[model samples]
Structure formats: C-alpha cells, structure tokens
Target chain A: MTRVRMDLFVSLDGYTTSDPTPDDPMGPDWGRLTAAYTATRTFRERIFGDTSGAGTTGVDDTYAAAFFEGIGSEIMGAGMFGLHTFPDDPDWKGWWGDRPPFGTPVYVLTRTAPRPSISMDGGTTFHFRNAAIGDVLAEATDAAGGQDVRVGGGIGTALEFLRADLVDDLHLMVAPIVLGRGLRLWDGVPALDRSHTVTTEVAESGTIHVTFTREQHA
Target chain B: MTRVRMDLFVSLDGYTTSDPTPDDPMGPDWGRLTAAYTATRTFRERIFGDTSGAGTTGVDDTYAAAFFEGIGSEIMGAGMFGLHTFPDDPDWKGWWGDRPPFGTPVYVLTRTAPRPSISMDGGTTFHFRNAAIGDVLAEATDAAGGQDVRVGGGIGTALEFLRADLVDDLHLMVAPIVLGRGLRLWDGVPALDRSHTVTTEVAESGTIHVTFTREQHA
Candidate 1:
C-alpha cells in the first residue's frame, strides 16, 4: 500500500494564504521557497525540460527535491485547482504556467461535474475527480505505481484525508509569522486524538521542519 | 491624518489560511504567528488581561510586542469576517473570542447589509462599514487618532486598499514556505506603479521580518 504524505509550509497560525484564491501577495513566496528546485538538475530537467540547474545546490533545495522526488501522484482540492472566482471555468487551468512543477499525475478534487483530463508536459496530467475521498485516493494510487502518493493540500482536501485518517505521514515547514486573521486550518474539525509521534525535526533558515508519522494503534 | 497599514504573513504562493475555516493543520501556524502579539506587556494586558505568558520573556517577546503595539484600528473583508458558507448568517461573529485581540474599533468591509455595532470588553468593537473604500478609511482614521490604522487583512480587503492607493505602508512578513495554492493577495487588482523600500530586516528564530514602506511615485 502506498503511504499518503502531505508536505507544505504553514504559517505559525496555519493559514495557507491570505484569502480564498492563489493570486494574493503571499503567492510570491512559492517561487522564493521553491527557488532551490529551479537550481537543481532533476527539477529543471523533469519539469522545465532544461539542463541549466545541474550541480547547483542549497540545503532547502536538497530537502525539497528529495520530497518532490518521492511523490508519485498529487491530489489537490478544487480551490487549489483554480482561483475561487474561476472555480467552474474549465478553461482556467491553474496559476502555474504551461508546465507545472509536479511531474506526476495531479488529481483535482471538486464538486463540479467531471471533465476530460488535461495533459501537460513531463508526463503530468490533470484529472478532475468528483468522487469521494476513498475513490480519489484509489485512483491516484493506481496512477502512482508503487511510489508514495502526496496530498497536495489546500486545507479542505488535507482535512478530508485527516478526518478519514487516510493520511499516513505529515511534513510541515512552519514559518514563524501570523496573519492575525484569514482562513485557518482545523477551523471546523473535531479535536484530534494525539497519537502521532514526531519523527524528525530540522531548524533551517528561519523555518522549523517537523515531520509526524501516525502510530499504529493496537 | 491617520495612515492605514496592512500587516500580514503570507506564503510564497499566497494564501491566508490552509483552509477557509480554521480546522485544518495548516491553520495552526496562524495561531503561532498571532501569539507573538501576546508577548508585549501592554498588548498582553490589553488582549488577555494578564502580563505573564508561557515562554514569552526573551527577545521573542520584544519582537512580538513591537509588531502589535504599533497598530491602531483594523479592517477585514466580508469573506474573512466568517466562513464562506455563512455569508447570509447575521449572527456569525469572527473566529476570535467575544473580546478580540484588537482593542480598537474594527471595520468589516462588505456589500452585505450592515449590522449594528458589536461591542466587547477590552475596548474591542465591531463596526460594519458598507461604504466606499475612501469613506471607510476616513472613518477609520478618525477612530485611529494619529496612529497607523492597521488593515486586518483578508487578501481581498488588502488588495482593495492597495488598488485605491489608500495604504500608506505595508508590513508583509513572508513566511519561508509555499502553500503552492490558495488565495493570492493581488489576484484581481489592476497593476500599480508602486515601489517598496525595505525599512528593516530581522531574521528571527522562526521567520524573517522585512518591512517595506511604499515609496512615493514620481
């Protein structure tokens, strides 16, 4: 069975953005945080079809590359797929340009009607899954071969997996800053049972990297 | 005249929260980020009615205190006032407790029908404003005295003020992470010929602080 992992950076308060869309000022951090990936040979070759980023490195870049290299497929929430206003527009793909960073199949969870798969470069394909969480996970697993399946989170999608206890591992790079107000993680969910054990901790460049793995309950 | 300053911690890709509401794992970062405000004696006494805090006695306390002590009034967007599902609910107060952290008056920008003022202890009051941005800013300035009125941003509200060129200063603390998705700060706004001059840079244990004062355009 492929373990489900979720990896993302979260504020000290746990908001994904300042609003319901991906075009906010906070959006630029993605490029900055992922700058290391662009400086990697694997990242450039796999996603951008370029050989420019060979041998260049940083600790952040290495960590990110390792994480991305392990992922076989990605499942994202509908809000993560499109801006909140353009949720229903089939024409609008995503904020990422023609070739997205993810070089694997991307499953978008939405309540909208199903549509045909949109194929991009580097073997990446966007599959809209209107089915339940279980169905989506199963399809993504099948599409992922035997590798790990990552939940490309947007709070809503990650909560569904967390609520279902379908998530196996979690990696959060906590940035020490607060929005004071915005969308929040764990806003409407029930209190969680503390069974997960911290498996790793790495403090790097003003961010804390923490990993938690679910413990097997007898 | 009082200047309105919007302060927020956003992801690289831009998102206010991990989810629309607060129940997601990514939402916890917001709590940690806002916890910085509790570090100040004045802010702590005003918000929580106490001076003692858990592990808030060092340099962290000073930095946190400085961030919150400078703000005056707060402004937020309608979607940020509550969950999107409760758009029609007149009874939905914000996620904050009865007495919010802001000791000053708060403005909730919305097209919805304005409600009566919600007064709370510690001098925090909720006043719904449905007027134009200019009128709202003017009212907020009067309420703020000579202090900088802080726009309690939800991306949309911040972008609106940024579009109108009403914001005098912006304190954007970029977290070292990427949501890779979620609400963006400048999603639908028209481009502006604005330039930012970095006033201060502080690399702390958890995140870097970069303050930018909007430079006067030629």
Candidate 2:
C-alpha cells in the first residue's frame, strides 16, 4: 500500500513558515522555525548535502532519518518549490539548487502554464500538475512505483491533502519558537482524534513530535 | 517572588474551548477537550467536588495539583465565568455552584454593570471588574496579599495577559484532540523563546505538559 505521509516543522503557534521577503528569499523565520530539524544528521546529509556527518544524532535525527525512509515520490506546492517567491523569474530552479534533495519523482502543484519537467542532478524530476488533491495523489502514486507518496509542504499544500483525508500519516515537529504571524497549518483541520490515532513524543531538544495516523474505519 | 501563573488545557491545535450553544451550553467540544484535565484527581476534587480520590494521579494530575498552589488571587474572563452562556440572566453565579473552587479573591473581567460581590460558601469571592489586564493584574496582585496571581483562562483571557508580557509562568497541557476550530490561545503571542524558557514533559496519560518560565532581563 502506498501510504500518504507528511512531515512538517511548525512553530509552537502553528506557523510552518514566514512570508518570503526580498532580504531573505527563504524567509528569515524559516531558519529559527526549522532549527531542530535542520540540525539533524539526516537533514545535514540528505537535505543540506553535508557528507561530513556533523549534525546531532539524537531523538530529532531519528525522526528526520525516518522522514525520507519509504518516500518514493513527492508532491509539493508551488510555494514550497520556491515558485511563490520567484513567480516571474523563470530561471529559479527552486531553493534546493541544481541537485534537489528529494531523489524521487516530484510533482509541483501549480496553475501556471504547462511547462516541461525539469530533471535535477539527483533522481528528482519536477513534474507540473494543476489538479485537485485526489487527482494529483493518484498521479503521484503511479509515479511512486508502489512506494509511499510523501506530501512536502509549506502549510497550505499539506492542509489541502489533510482536509481531503488523503494523508495517512502526519508527523509535525513543534519547535519552541512562536511565529506571531504566518500561514497557520491547523486552521481548517478538524479534530484529528475523531479519525486518527494521535501520539506525541517530547525530545530533549525541546521539540515535541506529534504523529497522527489515520484509523481505518468500517 | 509572586509570579503570575497560568495553566490551560488546550487541544493539540491550540483551541481552549468552543462556543456555547442552546442544547449544549459548554458546546460539545469542551468535554472531549478537557477530558485529561477533568479526569485528574485534583480536578475531580477541586472542580468536581469529588473527595473519594477516584481520579487518576498521573503526571497530568501532578500538574493539576500544582495549578492551585501559591498565595494569591485569580483573574478570569466573563466567558469563563459562564456570563457568556447566560448573558440575559443575572442570577447565574457561575458553573462552580454555591461553594465555588478558589479559596481566594477572584476577579472576573467583565463589561457588565458593577454588581455586588458574591461571597461563596468557600473563601472564594467573585469580584467583577471592568478594567484592562494591567489594572486587573495589579488589583489581583494587591488582593493576593503578596502571593502569586493566577490568570485563569478560557484562552482569550489568558492571551490578554500573555500578550502584555504580564504572565511569569505558563503551563499548558496539550490534549490529544484537534478541535478544528475555536478560540486559539497562541494566536498573537510572539516567539516565547524571546522572553521565556520553555520545557516539555510527556505524561503516561498522553498529555504533553509544556512550561514557559519568564526569563529575568537586566
């Protein structure tokens, strides 16, 4: 079964990322908001491309390593892919640069004109799609080759899949920082316990990891 | 030091409570949202008047027991005192019955006409005040007889104190439910790390106890 998974680093107040400003293309708040996750060994190796293994190998790294374990195909919003920051700049190859971290078939959800898919140095191939969550998930599943389909986010994209009940597992790392204002992730998400088995783990890094596994109902 | 303290039972998504309706005065959400808190021995005894020691005495109960410790008064919003549920009826003495809970001076922040103070069977005295958070906290601190001043909440009331940087110690229990909507407690509060030291402890009852102690600034 190709389960839909999501892993988001959110502020204590539910903000996943701050608005992108010219001074800070990735948003000045993203660093502080995602400090714990970015400090993990897996993040430094997989996401940051640091082969020196200089990151923490504690509880946080364990979860970070598990995040990319079974993921075969990735579906992300245009915002997460940096299109929201550089909508007019056609030269932007995403914030991840030439060799994107996601070594899988990536689906970028957008309503812009259909363009050719961009293949990165890694196995990552960015495919453009303009469809509802279900349709895109179906396409992502087919591209996943029976592996898990991961929903990469910028909050808005993740909520769309969650609200549609398409996500099977959600792992949210609650950082201690509180972004007073930004895009809230849990705004329209209904009481998850009604349909999911929710559990929590507190890491020594002051990050509370919350996982919501959707329950199979009769 | 008489630190201003707060202990709120909030959902995983940050909702403190739901709106009261005709059929369900406290709304259907409050019961499930407050299950962990209400099931504690301290809650069963203090809030429910259960003296049989029937409730669980776990990590949640330990925090529940500490919630009332200190020498002081309490500041609460009108909604928390049940005035919102029975706005037209002036006879409602709150949901705590005749004796009430707190054995100290209780200041209810309300915009209604100044009514005579109600001295419950217990030492609790309900004093209605139509003033800002600073003024009320000052009065509550003075009335507390040099002890701690607790800001009892239904979320909005607590946010008022937190936003003003008046609360010294905040202890929030994150319940397992995701109330899709309600009064969010962390809405306008900026990154707490800027002013407070945050720590988390997960209980056997699945409630994550988060504490934020105000840092002393020069």
- Top model by DockQ, which number? 2
Best by TM-score: 2
In terms of TM-score, how similar is model 1 to the real structure?
Answer: 0.46
TM-score of 2: 0.91
| Candidate models: Cα lDDT each | 0.63, 0.83
> How do the residues A121-140 of candidate 1 rate in per-residue lDDT, one tens digit apiece?
66678988889999999999
lDDT string, candidate 2, A1-218, tens digits: 78899988788878777776544544678888788888888988887679997998998999998987988899998887877777887767788788888889999999887667899998889998988888989999999998999998767788888887788888999987777877788877866787889989888788889999976621
Off by over 4 Å in 1: A22-58, A83-98, A188-193, A215-218, B1-218
Instruction: Please list the residue runs of candidate 2 whose C-alpha ends up more than 4 Å from where it truly belongs after superposition.
Output: A21-25, A49-53, A86-92, B21-25, B48-52, B86-92
Q: How would you encode candidate 2's per-residue C-alpha lDDT over B12-65 as one tens digit per residue?
A: 888777765544544678778678888889988988779998998989889988
Model 1: per-residue Cα lDDT at residue A142:
91
Instruction: Give the range where candidate 1 chain A is weakest over 10 consecutive residues by summed lDDT.
Output: A186-195
TM-score of each: 0.46, 0.91
